[model samples]
Target: MMGGARVRQEEPSVQKEANSWVFARSFRSEEEAVRLANDTPYGLANAVYSVDAARLARVASQLKSGIVWENCSQVLFPSTPFGGKKGKASGFGFEQGLAGLKEFLAEKTVVGTSRPSYNWQIYKKA
Candidate 1:
């Protein structure tokens, strides 16, 4: 763990309310930070600060967490899928745009019928 104080500083207010949880602080470099983030047994969300877009992309790819916030904290949109890696159980499918809407619905496919029916399946199941 980076440090209790550091995690507290980087985490959001809601996250702070979870007494059972521990937050890790921001890393100096994307590499160092990602290393620490990935090292943890639980792969959750990771926040990165990078003024450079290229650097952010590089770091985002390396992070073990499912969600990576560049120069920001937390996932903001419902359409944006949020989940965790490693042992942390968050989610398993995308949650944004049409893809996200699909997650909440079921699709049925009818074949060889008088009228053609579209397939409605959950995003993850599909």
Candidate 2:
């Protein structure tokens, strides 16, 4: 229904600071989708639902959000940094993971999350 839609959305998802409101819209291609997503100043977190891993990686890379979930949303972990990026949408630093460690300490930060703890297959098509 959205044809070269306006970046400004009146919906609660765009209006409210923290919300679970899921925004759904139609797009002609991935490029359009990325454009629509990055249009927002809030770069907190976003999810990409795709069967193609390559496409997921590509789209996730383009998203300006601080956290990008592949085929998953709101998946929290102690080893992962939970925060956002941008003007008003972001804060000083992340609250978890290596970022959090860096916040409390001064010398050096060491955390092992290079390999995600969760299974990638969970998001994949069975």
Best by lDDT: 2
What TM-score would candidate 2 get against the native? 0.67
**17-106: candidate 1 lDDT, tens digit per residue:** 343554556556657666656654455577777688998899889987767888887657865656556455455655666666877899
- 104, model 1: CA deviation in Å? 6.6
Please count the clashing residue pairs in each candidate, in the order shown: 7, 0
Q: Write the per-residue lDDT of candidate 2 for residues 1-126, one digit (tens) a residue.
A: 122254345555564555645666767899988987777657788888999999999999998877999988889999988888746466666789998787787796665555555545457545
Report, for every candidate in turn, its global Cα lDDT versus the true structure. 0.62, 0.75
lDDT of 2: 0.75
- True-vs-predicted CA distance for residue 108, candidate 1, Å: 10
